[model samples]
Target: MGIEPKNLAGWSDLLEQAVKDTLIPSMKTQEYTWDTTDIVSDPKRLAAFVALSSAGESIQVGFSGEPSDVASVVSQMFGFDDLEDAGDDYSEILDGLAEIINIVAGALHRSLSSDGNNLQLSIPLLIHGEIVIQGKEEWVAHRLTIGDNNIDAIIIRGLIQKQKD
Candidate 1:
């Protein structure tokens, strides 16, 4: 059976903490706001992104931004000073972001599974280019800035049909 989720406010809190714990302390976090930015439709297209699957994938989590933005956040995550695109290593940044997503997903899974369903987190999926998160009806997005860079934090969740035994 699929695990059920509780009120998303709890999930959102954990997500915010994951970002702060994983990427803060290394960069000057300018501001955080829970805003509905149409990142998929934005011209910048967030350059690169990472996604995590829920138990049965009824929920989805994503973080995305330009290579420069990715490097800025990720460099800080690894305790490296932010650098320009000209000197940043793409692979390292993406991998680090993936790891962060994995951590966030695990936290969400555990909290959502109040019934002790033993939900498992999926491998972080890293991708480049434009993408859209499914199930927007349950979405609650937030945005944060570190230096001049901004990244989108998204959660797309919805009702999952009960599985037949």
Candidate 2:
């Protein structure tokens, strides 16, 4: 069993709060949107690159620009050391993105879970390659807008069970 419907609602509420509490305060978020698409073709490869070592199912979230920009903003918001790219190793860049995703997801999980239980999160995976977003017959596309930026968060509700079977 992974996250449930009722729990997913909780996640959504928490995600909204996280944006207000963390991302919005730090950056001038413009036109934000929440949506989910199938990971059909690895929409963003950077996310997957970061998660390769962690072996956990991943959900893709699309933001604006390159890793550096995202990293810089997130680092400042979280009060962490600036992320620098030493050479071409993208792992570092992906690591920063993962952190942001983790924060958002963790916050959502906590808000939804009973007794404030923490949800286990896999290391953040960064997908950099071109990805094709498509919806299945049973799944319809969903979207939400915040500020000027479009935030896309996908949910893998029964990911664990799917993997097991």
Candidate 3:
């Protein structure tokens, strides 16, 4: 099962802290500041999601933002002096996107698991378009700013699926 609705706020705070503690520094830049914001909108953007599970409970975390902004952060994370140094290929950009999520998710996993939750994480998946929800899972969405980039973070609590006997 997913994290309960009642605990979502606390978990949201943890998630935001994880982002601040992990994502910002990993960008390898000092100009970026992390702060809560409204959900973002960009016609074309880059996104990634990672699934974190513990025993019967699980949640999905996602990060998405405009392509240019994401690419800028990724470039900085890679220590590239400029975007061109990071390459112009789409696949390369996607890989960079996946890498950042992996870093953030891995850190989050370690923190939660340390508290005896024993969380496991799926590989970060690069996605296009919106996150699709097929069940009645409770979720929380938070938008954060990294410098001028507006990135959206989504947490979708898992719903336990029963098996037929």
Off by over 4 Å in 3: 1-6, 27-43, 82-88, 159-165
Between candidates 1 and 3, which one is better according to lDDT? 3
Distance (Å) between predicted and true CA of 159, model 1? 13
Query: Rank by lDDT, descending?
Result: 3, 1, 2
TM-score of each: 0.68, 0.51, 0.77
lDDT of 3 by residue, 92-148 (tens): 666787888788878777887676666778887776544555457877777766666
Q: CA lDDT, every prediction? A: 0.59, 0.44, 0.67
Top candidate on lDDT is 3
Badly placed stretches (over 4 Å) of model 1 are: 6-10, 42-57, 81-83, 86-89, 110-117, 133-138, 158-165
Clashes of 2: 25
Tell how far residue 5 is off in model 1, in angstroms.
Answer: 2.6
Q: Which lDDT tens digits does candidate 2 get at residues 31-132?
A: 455565333333233332111012233333233234455555555556667454443555666666667666666555555456443345556545665433
lDDT string, candidate 1, 34-152, tens digits: 55566444333333323334345555577777777777677766777644454535677777667667766665555556646566565666655545434535676677666687777
